[model samples]
Target: MKRWIPWLAAAAVVVLVGGGAWRAMAARQQQQKALAQAASQRAEAPMQLAASELVGVVRRSLVLGVPVSGSLRATESAMVKARVAGELQGLTVREGDSVRAGQVLARIDATESQARLRQAQQQADAARAQVDINQRTVTNNQALVNQGFISATALVTSQASLESAQSTYRAALAAADVAKKSLEDTVLRSPITGQVSQRLAQPGERMPIDGRVLEVVDLSRLELEALLSPADSLAVRVGQRAQLQIEGSAEPVVATVARINPSAQAGSRTVPVYLAIAQNRGAPALRQGLFVQGLLDTGRADVLTVPLDAVRTDKPAPYIQAVRDGKVAYLPVKTGARAVVDGQTLVAVEGAPEGTVVVSGRMGQLREGTAVTTAATPSAPVAAASAPATRPAP
Candidate 1:
């Protein structure tokens, strides 16, 4: 009976040990089952994304171009300067005043000019009288010489005096014409039909010759001057089109390449490209010296492309997050050239076909295999806000 008791105790000990092992195995199985259920629930829940967080791939003509920026200038501008030195008078026009070609804009005090002109005219009149007297004297001397009443030497001396008087009279006439021109210069006229952009000299102020008085610019025709790199400028040609965003203007202005500087700038070595702006009706008027920036369309290419912001570089290889079968899928792409389409900067890329819905960089990183739906769907934004925040696997 004692031996039987020891054997039974051993069997009981084995059974207790077996029961503990069974409990541990059962608990582990329950835990794993619970984790699997939770994962399935997460997967079933679709993340709702805003419309701005996604962009569609498109295949269209991509405008290949170089980025350019510069200031707007009037194609025909004139600087009205004083041609005569005198006190400015009758100057009524100011900045923003309209002017017409050959219209009298202002005048310098003509008192000094008129006096000089009168003096020159009087001198010319005196010279004219002297010329007439010299002619009469030459005729009388010739007659006397012919009749032998005067010696030949005396007649020759009289002829020399007459010649000197005639030369002086011609010189006086030239001086008078110069004085008349100076008098006319006192009256300033607009060389072009446009609006005055600047009024440098005021009325009653003494103006010197060639002194700037007013600046006139024809807003009807404007041009943009852009400087570009040598390599980029090489591709630029006359007649290329560009869209410029002018300062203070809401609508973008269209411009065409007009001319290009043959030689590069000395210090910066940049080429200057002039673009003539086309004035469109109902568009905001452009002004000279306004800041402008745009892209010069050098060429065009038709290809599948996406917004440049859609290409993600946060991974070992450049990839874009695309929605495939309603799940986030990372697509590896080989990027090509960048271009602007419809004013948006887009990049050419392979591995993605047209009409593929891809995530925008603004959406941040999303986990693989995650289900996604647009905000228009019934899913609430609050529910899926945390879904997009999921970090990608390393």
Candidate 2:
């Protein structure tokens, strides 16, 4: 009887253990099934968004510009030099002084020139007196020949003397004219209207003919000397517009293609392109030899564009999050020119079609084919209480 009681006890313990294990397994299976059902319901649910969050893509003309860098220079520039040699006696203009065409800028010491002119004038006068005396002598000789008081040979000699005196008088007159011209050249005048950029000679300094006095440049007629490759030069044409950004200048100066050098630079394949600055009201002051950067507008085309922020750049290829049929759709796009339109920075895109609605601002996490709802239109406001209300339906 005792042995039978021990076996029964063992069987009861085994049954209790097996029952506990089965219950644990059942609980785990039910928990996993519940989790799977919850996930499926969430996936079927739609995503909702406000209408104001979406921005429509637009089509507009985008101007494309080719970037170039070079230096700024005056289109018309001259180095003021002395035409005659003398001591620079007076200089009325200095560096940075504005001058007009034909304005006298400096004076050379003309004391010696003046004295030489006067001396030549005196010689001319003496020669003229000699000519007068010779003329009277020739007239006397001719009368003597008519009266037969003197031989014909002697009268001919007197005529030859008069001719000699006339030649001397002409020579003296030419010398006087030369001296007058030299004296007039002692004053240096500006040949063009411009500002003095350099003062090469000081007052009271002696200078020779063609000696540099100052450098004058026409500031209003400035140009940018841009170097372009052979390929780029072909695209640039005369009359094309460009924007120049000079070093140290806050605003860009507008310019146009003035001329293109037919030949390439020596030893280099680059061509020299000259851009003429356009005249503008209140244009910023520009100087010669200023380093500059330029953007030449080559062509323009109509393209689809969206706000810069709407394009996502982190992925392997640039794409935009577009909302189509109330579902999220990712679109891969190729970007082109970037420009500002209506006070917003917009990027030109190629793949996206016009009028495609894109998610402009950062909304919560969005997935492919995720459902969305735009904000509903607002209902009309109710009439004021003071106003007569419509009667209840009969």
Per TM-score, the best of the predicted structures is 1
Q: Where is the poorest 10-residue window by lDDT in model 2?
A: 384-393
Candidate 1 lDDT over residue span 239-260, tens digit each = 9988778776779888899999
lDDT of 2 by residue, 315-365 (tens): 898888888887899999988766644455666787888878887646633
Which parts of model 2 are misplaced by more than 4 Å? 1-64, 151-156, 301-394
| All candidates: TM-score | 0.72, 0.60
Clashes of each: 0, 0
Superposed model 1: Cα runs more than 4 Å off = 1-60, 313-336, 339-345, 350-394
What value does the lDDT take at residue 97 in candidate 2?
A: 90
Q: State the lDDT at 22 in candidate 2.
A: 90
**Residue 326's C-alpha lDDT in candidate 1?**
84
Pairs clashing within candidate 2: none
